[model samples]
Target: MFHRSVLVQKVLEFLLTADDGVYVDATIGDGGHTLAILNAAPKATVIGIDSDKSALETTKERLKFFGKRLELVHGDFENLDDIVLGQLGYGSVDGVLFDLGLRSVMVEDRFRGFSFKKPGPLDMRFNTDETLTAYDVVNRYSPEDLERILREYGDVRGARKIVEKIVDARKKTPITTTEQLAEIVVAGLPQRVHTDVLARVFQAIRIEVNREFEKLERGLYAALEILRPGGRLVVISYHSGEDRIVKHFMATESRDCICPPGLPVCRCGHKRQIKILTKKVVRPSQEEIKQNPRARSARLRAAEKL
Candidate 1:
């Protein structure tokens, strides 16, 4: 069971605007944060959206007691605007919470291939219907493209070596499983490299397979558009890449002018749309981290619409 909700107390404290308002859990996962919101604000209603059907099913069963107050939707958050407008129309939502950590249910499931510790098929698609999988990327992508993904997404130091090994191995036989890929990555690196090298390699492939970065960018903008003035947007991201995107988006939107530094005039016409609530990024407390180690990497930023 995906039972842990990281920073639950802080999320409720910062995210809820009123006792009764519409809230959207953009990545509801197993409804941990959604359930927290409902518990905090008894009169509030939540629109929970997730790409994985299995996640939605788990969330539904876990939160069934909430009754009609929770509306579970099966879709990617990238289409947040369409989902919100189609279901509830525009500009009325009070808060949107994005808990960006992948749930333990997904990681622990050997079939998902998210963890190198588990032996599984190289299928990391959040939505299983997606055509691209880790298997396809490892076997079909050109050496140049493979190196790029490893370097950009994983921040792997020896990306070229990893790609070279992958290309060489694939020539002999298709690298179809997580274990096989991990072995190749381990063999490519020098003996001094940390074991985490394998994990980084796998993570890069998973990110590309799911298009997480693109979806996150779209979802953040859409969340901003749907929030009414004074409404809140709270995001909790689990990695540096994701935290950087959320941080930059909030900083850019909260600034009045985004024109070139040397420009004498403001030609961009960009207006400050939201006010950043947390001057510094918030992290889970030591106690919280001790309880849930997964929360250690979480960086939370919040802003209110102007």
Candidate 2:
């Protein structure tokens, strides 16, 4: 079974104040938050979007009790304007919830290659329709390209060594499975830091397979555009790379003049779009983290459109 959502109560409490509001659960993984949102406000309508078709079906099954109150769409949240706004005929949305990172079900599915602990196909595409996978990346990318991805996406310090080892191993025999690729990464790292290093390498490959960063870049802008003037944008990010972009957008979008600090007059009329609610990111409580270890790294930041 998939793990319970990380911050259900906190998210629900925020949306409760707005009655009969329209909400969007961008990464509606299995509809955990979608159910909560519906439960909180009976009049609220939720548009749940997920790129994984299987997960969307599973979500539909789980939320069948809600009937017409919930709408499930088999599409990426990145295309919010077309899939959500245009189709729904809404000028702006009331609340937006983005649960970033792989869901529990995705990680558990060995065929998805999201977890290194299991031996499965090296396919890490969240959409499943994507042509590239961890298998394609490992076997096709140049050593330099591999090193760059590991260092940038994975934040792996031994990226060069890991890339060299991956290239050498693939030349001898194709790295086809999660176990095989993970073993190669483990072997390349120092004996003491093998597990940590292996995880970083795997994460790097998964990020590349999904074009995760690019999606985030486009998605955040579209999300803001689709939100109403007083609407809220809630984002829960697991990694620093993802959090950096969210934090930057929240700050930049909320500013009146994005000009350099040394500017004498405010010439760039970049109006403040959103009001950042959390001065610092809100993390799960100690008790919550103790119950769900995965919640330990999750950080939540919210903003309201101006």
Give me the candidate number with maximum TM-score: 1
Return the TM-score for candidate 2, rounded to 2 decimals.
0.96
* Cα lDDT listed for each candidate: 0.89, 0.86
User: lDDT at 183 for candidate 2?
Assistant: 84
Identify the runs in model 1 with alpha carbons over 4 angstroms from their true place. Answer: 88-91, 188-194
Which candidate has the highest lDDT of all?
Answer: 1
Model 2 / residue 58 / CA error / Å: 1.3
Query: What is every candidate's alpha-carbon RMSD to the true fold?
Result: 1.3, 1.4
User: How large an RMSD does model 2 have?
Assistant: 1.4
